[model samples]
Target: MSDEIAVPPRQDNQQWLRWIQAQYGGPACIRRGKRLHDALAQLEQSLARFRQPGHDDDWLAMVRIRLGQLHALAGDWSKLEPLLDADSLRIVQQLYTDLQPQLRLPPAPDPRPDVLRTALQELQEAIAFFNRRWLRHLQSLDLSFYERLIADYNRYYLLEKECLLQSPRLARLGFQPLPSLTWQSLLGRFPLLPMPRLRNETSEH
Candidate 1:
């Protein structure tokens, strides 16, 4: 993806794009961890651009707010620091306050009106990030974090589901719940036992 975000003047979309690109691998190499890292990096660039000179205040505010959310989704704690830092706390606090309403909306309708397939892939990547990592964090957090994380996940998941439901192109896809209980059963049976790897059958002979 291009690093140019096409934001208003003094908006270093290029810089933001560069930072974001730094987090992910080339198109062929993009994986879950790399995607998460790239998302956070993009978000941070959005945050940094807000403080740069000549940027539109309203646009910057919106971008940073969304960036916070993207950061939250990607588990980018480092990006949160600016918001929590004593000097920037007020800005951070207001960002969250403003973000609450925006979060309620469905995600930007898959940008590709012509190609629903690409949009489906985008949604899958977005959801897979939560299923693999963020959801686990949500399930394990202390009361406070759990509440916040689950709410975020719920909103995101519902939005994705809504899009899928509306898309006639995606009618063939079926929902498959992940196996969460299997790991626990294995742990219960083995306690401290190390998992064994399968050996090659031919090697045994």
Candidate 2:
């Protein structure tokens, strides 16, 4: 008798597409990381080559902000983890996961519109949760550290917001910008929280 051949189970187009995405997505993520690293290197070279007189500080500040953004794109959590305690770090980790696709360069041809829409909704939910809980989490921590971490989060958030706004695909997916954080807004939201301790207080104690 002739050997029997094993037939694979049939999958619908959407199922097959999802399978392909899952299989290829890992390498795609690596490629995206490489591209971002390259772009950051190029930006650094440009900054070095075109340092304008009298605008040195401005240029440096802009480049540092861009570097922070690139670090986020690369998922360099080390930059943040040291500044946060375990609970706050966990919140930031989730926020970064949601923000990643929005920050990175878009994949060509894009995912299906439905998939993109669902992702945007999920991202929005993550941001809302972070906004609601982050300040509360900060209240028990060292005030100076809280301010530093919040500042870093705000910078990364601004960069992510700008990327989403600039992407036509993201705009069509109904991405809405999160409100920018400021000292006044932060105080307003958590008015009763004790002021972050001053450096001298720690020194004196």
Best candidate, lDDT: 2
lDDT by residue (1-205, candidate 2, tens digit) is 8687634348875665455457565333233444544654553454333223234432223222332343433344454333334554454455344223232443333234343334333333434444444445434333354344445443454454344345545533542333444545544643321111211223111
Q: Which stretches of candidate 1 lie over 4 Å from their true place?
A: 1-158, 168-172, 178-191, 194-205
> Model 2: clashing residue pairs?
none
Best by TM-score: 2
lDDT (0 to 1) per candidate = 0.37, 0.40
Superposition error at 12 for model 1 (Å): 26
Per-residue lDDT of candidate 1, residues 88-138 (tens digit): 334434434543424444344332323333322333343344234423533
Question: Going through the candidates in order, what is the number of backbone clashes in each?
Answer: 0, 0
- The true-versus-predicted C-alpha distance at residue 141 of model 2, in Å, is 4.2
How many Å off is the CA of 199 in candidate 2?
Answer: 47
